[model samples]
Target chain A: MIPAKFDYIKASSLGEALTLLQEHGDEAKILSGGHSLIPSMKLRLATPSVLIDIGGISEMNTITEEGDEIVIGANCTHHQIATSDLVREHVNILSQAALCIGDIQVRNRGTLGGSLAHADPASDYPATVLACEATIVAEGKDGKRTIGANDFFQALFLTALQDDEIITAIRFPKVSQGTYQKFFQSASRFAVVGVAAIKKGDGVQIGVTGVSGVPFRATAVENAYDGTSSAAKHAMDGVDDIISDHFADEEYRSHLARVYVKRALEAL
Target chain B: MNISITINGKLVTHDIEPRISLSHFLREHLDLTGTHIGCDTSGCGACTVTLDGQAVKSCTVLAVQADGSEVTTIEGMAQGDQMHPIQEAFREHHGLQCGFCTPGMVMTAADILKNNPNPTEEEIRHGLEGNFCRCTGYHNIVKSIQHAAEQMKA
Candidate 1:
């Protein structure tokens, strides 16, 4: 099936892309790798009037280390992050999650920024990022501002990013150890139930995906495990309100969440 | 819009609509029909190609987004009349039956082998989570990739 007609403009720089977005506002969509947007466009689910291709901006494709955090440009492909030495060293769980995103092809073309901006509830990186407590940097006509991972994903396919704002980069703090486990749906390969756990000092932050509108922390489980190993065992005692529709129902996902949370905690 | 790209080691330029996918640009514009378009949605990997040395679903990529990039398709995998090792292994191991998903499967496997020279059988299965083959039940495809990995390592 062919997509609806649209105008395409390849912007060479961020300023140029921002100007295009400011001009078109919600009517204009930024095309990075187009792994998520183009497919939706082909299905007529998202038909924008103008597509500003920001893929040519070299600055948006970099992965760098800044002091205590790793700053990844929004355009960095899953392949880039999965194979980067720095990411493997400091945040290996992110790389592990990146490697499990899709098939070889999807990882090569899909960008971290694009995935985060799309904010799919089942996306792998969102839970990993949320577990790592990453920060999303957004730029627009009003300049740049940072949003915490907790507040970044607002709803399903929704983000705190303004209509004219573009996600510039995502910054992740260094952690001692982290692990991501995903139960992928057979057909789409999205996370039917994914758990990302990070060991920070004396506590653990557990992020759950594919069971909610947005990737959210399993605070009930966190509170349970606050200072004991029994926390891992009894993590899913009170998180019944988080699960939703998809490949698995609330009961099954809750069960998987309990299993994965225990496994993730044991691994850490 | 006018876009110039390096496809399968050759430089080609074309005028395309903003909505024209890279898969269509290759099949329709350049006539490189080896890259099959199985699903218009990105769920299927039948339109897989190597973009800048990494496998990507061409159906999900816009031609304009591929500007200044290098693309390699199944047609570029072989040299002259010789089939690529992965293609040869697929034929020997009976990796395909209907052949509709062969090209994309081979390309996706080739990309996986390039990254993981010694992938485990489990890794091979997990790596191919994106590309689906309705035929063969994936037993022989796994064997084909395992054989190709050994051959490539040799």
Candidate 2:
């Protein structure tokens, strides 16, 4: 499936990418891993006239430690994160979630920033990032800023990222214990219902995806946590707009959400 | 866009449109038809190829993205007349029925073995989740990979 005709510019650096983005404005689309973007373009869902390939930007491809947080570059592939010892030690839920995304071939090329920026409701990272309270770092011609995971995902296939801004890194706080449980949708391997649970002292934070139009932190489940799986029942207490498709209807998706949430919490 | 790529140890350059996918480039431009395209979408791994040591679905990757990268398709597997151990295993174990998904399965198997030289049955099954064989010959495919792993290890 061929995508629409477009001019491809391989940016040598982050600044060049930003300049190209601003110059092209609405006509441009940032090509990171291109796993999501390229497919969308092939389907004619996205027909940007200019593609600013940011794969050459070396600065946005590293994983580092910054004080209390493990800063992961946006361009880091899912395979890289899944195998990173630092990520495994600090925030293992991110690693677990990364391992659950797509498949080996997909994980080898797909980027975390691309996935988060695409903001697919069934994507695995959103739940992990929300559970970890990760911070997404964005850069643009104006400057740089960070958006917490809670505020990053706005709607289905929508993010808080501006047109010209690029996600450079994601900062995840150090967590000792966490787990990700996902019921895959078979063909695409996207989450039918994915739940990420983080154990913090006496409390827990839950993040759910694939059950609604927007991936969200399950504050109700967290609030109802009594050190037992019984709290998983509240997984859909406030999560309306439940997605129903041929893969799963609303009732089954909700049941899977609750089941996966319980599994994640029990695993923690 | 002008792009250069190393395919099966041969560096080739082409000035093509930016919309051409790596799978299309390999099949159309280079005439390397070993990399089949079952589902134009990324769901099917029939277009699987190694881009700089990583197994990726070539259909989803733009040809321009592969500039200056080393790509290994199924056609690159054999050495002279002697087939690669994995390919030989497939032939010996009768791993393929229709042979449509063989290239992708072989390439993905190579990647799986490269990463884990001694993968168990469960690991091989897990690694092969991307490639689909409509012929339902997965049992032999798994066996072929196990035999190939042993052959490569020895």
Question: What is residue A87's positional error in candidate 1, in angstroms?
Answer: 1.1
lDDT of 1: 0.86
What are the clashing pairs of model 2? none
Could you give candidate 2's per-residue lDDT for residues B44-141 as a string of tens digits? 89999999988999999999999999999998999989999999999999999999999999999999999999999999998999999999999999
Q: Each model's TM-score?
A: 0.94, 0.99
Q: Write the per-residue lDDT of candidate 1 for residues A108-226, one digit (tens) a residue.
A: 87899999999888889988888999999999999999999999988878899999899999999987799999898878778988889998878889888887777788887777675
Model 2 ranges with Cα > 4 A deviation? none
Off by over 4 Å in 1: A226-229, A232-243
- Superposed by TM-score, candidate 1 places the C-alpha of residue A189 at a distance from the truth, in angstroms, of 1.6
TM-score for chain B of each model, two decimals: 0.97, 0.99
DockQ score of each predicted structure, in the order shown = 0.83, 0.85
